[model samples]
Target: MPTNQIEVLGHAISNGKGVQLNLDIAKLHTRTKIQVPIIVERAKKEGPTILITAGIHGNEINGVEIVRQLVSKKYNKPECGMVICIPVVNVFGFLNQKRQFPDGRDLNRVFPGSPRGSLASRFAYHIIKEIVPLVDYCIDFHTGGDGRFNIPQIRINEGDEETLQLAKVFAPEFIVQTGHRDKSFRHTLHKLDKKVLLFEGGKSLHIDDAVSKAGVSGALRVMQHLGIRDFSKELESMDAKIKKPKVVKSSSWIRATYSGMFHPFVKLGSKVSKGDVLGSISDPFGYFERNVKARFPGYVICINESPIVNQGDGVLHISRD
Candidate 1:
């Protein structure tokens, strides 16, 4: 409840220029000691504390790059607030280019975690305890998981007008009104009345420059809108306008019926209708091929680009009407 100063990693710094600190892990072996990295920047003025986090799933590199570019820029001095950027929340998974933590846990799924639980859980608990309470608004960045690709989009909890408005300010290609699942960080923050916007773009392990630029611009736009920054000259020129996105109540995955090489007929962001051929799965011999068709009309928001697939593996995702 103090205005002039805040404590991060047990180090108190008066709110002025900005500060960066690493959130230490509970047990640090030489191999894992460097896993937790959280950077906080508090402005000299009193304003809303906004958090920008990425790499909750580890392999989502676009979000990581977005945070990097945002913090590196010399913007209008934060006149009224602070910006906390946690570029890599799951460092172990990132090292191996995996989606989950080293303990094989999906960090995003386990939120408001227990300090005495597993590694991922403890990390989550520490974050909730030390970081979540200090922020007024949050924006978590993400991308499609390994083997999957996504069009740039913002996912917000349905019916939260403030969060919706914030998402619109980001102006992503799509705005998905989704509900929170139990134990998600977004859900936990929502319980505390903090509006957190989740942005998803590109594919895991790959850098999509377009998405990264858009993401950084989006965050700056929000900052400008929130009065953290004075001007939008930097953001105004970037392509951060809201596009009417396809709204799906839910989405379903199209799985491979047999093991084979895949040929996608549509790319990410392509709109499709019922009975359209989304792709084809062909046998190694090329003697047999099965057409993958859209079950309903909607958008092809995600598709698997791995080229090889096993039977029943997720191949494509459609936002159904």
Candidate 2:
């Protein structure tokens, strides 16, 4: 493929510095069209092509912010190779502040999509066809959904050697060796022979400065390690370590036994043992109270921030080892 070729589907630019591309999507209205924003910067010399994707889930604003800051301010002028940043992959959901698209589809779940399928499926297909093949590695960013927060962590396949090394380069406080689900973006990328790192932190619709900063810094560190940039002089060694993350083969939601006000005793990232009182559900009238206890030892990766809760509503998510 030519470096600076522009097609009806997308526009590519090669300005000696690098190549930037903008992909157009199928339109619903004449005036409004959804587009996948992509910017690729390839240096004069040869190097790795790293894909940085954010907003896979529309509500994950921290990742989007991190990628924006990275491309516009940090990696605008690169030392070598290419850095491809896709700031918002799910524009429809983002506009409405919803996690899934109006079509009631989770874009992340429909990876390696089909060309002649549903709207979300077509979008996913275009990404796999036009983007994934051009990259050597990838970093997908995400966060906890509405009313939930997560501690900064990197999730990668346990057996992939290159992925494990890249996860360490990310320097997140926790390295989660997770299993891949069918049709997930990470799983699809792995099938395509790309080493993609997943970073989860903060919460939806909220800005956690610490999470955002850590995300950007970690990305830069990965770029540096890949020989894309030389930041040793200007950047300090991060204190982040690769701890044996609380491994959870599977997690279940803790539902409220009764409807009432919720008062969480523990926050995200806190470890809890079995029988620990995680929180309490109390009636607004203060006549009745129920204690929410952990059924197993694990980390509290996500908790409800909303004060109000109803019977059978999910209150906390525990990931057990």
Candidate 3:
């Protein structure tokens, strides 16, 4: 509860000061040192402490960009509380452009891990031991896996009204009410009574300008709402189209019935009626083709951008009544 005892990576950071520390835990097969940089900023006055993190899945480039922009723009500097930004958590995977650690483990699936565990587990354990205790709230950014492109949305556990309100303040196109994944970073934080907003947008290995803007604007808005800083001028300049996030209580995937070239018809976050043509699949040759139709009325939250898909592949994610 002491304000003066703010230490990261064993270095003390006094009030009204900022520091850049590195988590150097492992080495590559070639003995190259990979350090994960963590940026910290604090205010003289005491307030909530929030940690902004990205790249749990290293190939999620848009998430990394969002946190990077926050640090480069000095948006992480708080006027009251403390702001900790870890732009890329899985430096190993990041360097290799992979979604998992070098040891073939998903960094997100191993949380609050053991020191003697696998490479990813050790990294998770270190983070939990050295950093997570200091955080009051967290915003973990991510993009869809593989070729799935997700509309900007905030995902939180159902029945957490406080977190729901914060998601509302984030103002993404949709707020997905979902259950927590076992051993996920969000799940670990939730157990520690830390509020976390899991942001999903764009797609792995690619960055979209609209997704970046949505992410940055949402973080600024959340920070302002938390009284960490005032971003009125910044937000106004961005001219972001802040949506009253539609709370998605339930959703379902529309899978492909045929295998072939995939072409989507509707835009991201667009609403459609049942039986609408969401996309089409055709054989590489002109021999076969089929149109995919919606089974229910809802907003399209995700679209598979892959040029080719197999039968039973989930081509679109739509909200359900």
* Every model's TM-score: 0.92, 0.88, 0.97
lDDT values, one for every candidate? 0.81, 0.79, 0.93
lDDT of 3 at 314: 91
* Ten-residue stretch with the least lDDT total in model 3: 25-34
Q: Which stretches of model 3 miss by more than 4 angstroms? A: none
Question: Whose TM-score is greatest here?
Answer: 3
lDDT of 2 by residue, 1-321 (tens): 234432323544453455555676666545567776777776666677788998988878888888888877756456766777888888777888888865779988898999888788888999899878778889999988777677788888778878887787777766777788888999999999999899988889888888987788788778889888886654455444334444444666789988899999997778899999999999888799989999988888778887998899889988767
Q: At residue 161, what lDDT does model 1 achieve?
A: 80
All candidates: CA RMSD (Å)? 2.1, 3.1, 1.2
lDDT of 3 by residue, 104-174 (tens): 99999999888899888888998999999999999999999999999999999999999999999999989
Candidate 1 lDDT, 105-125, residue by residue in tens: 899888899988888899899
Candidate 3 global CA lDDT score: 0.93
- Tell me the lDDT of candidate 2: 0.79
Which stretch of 10 consecutive residues in model 1 shows the poorest summed lDDT?
239-248
TM-score winner between 2 and 3, please give it: 3
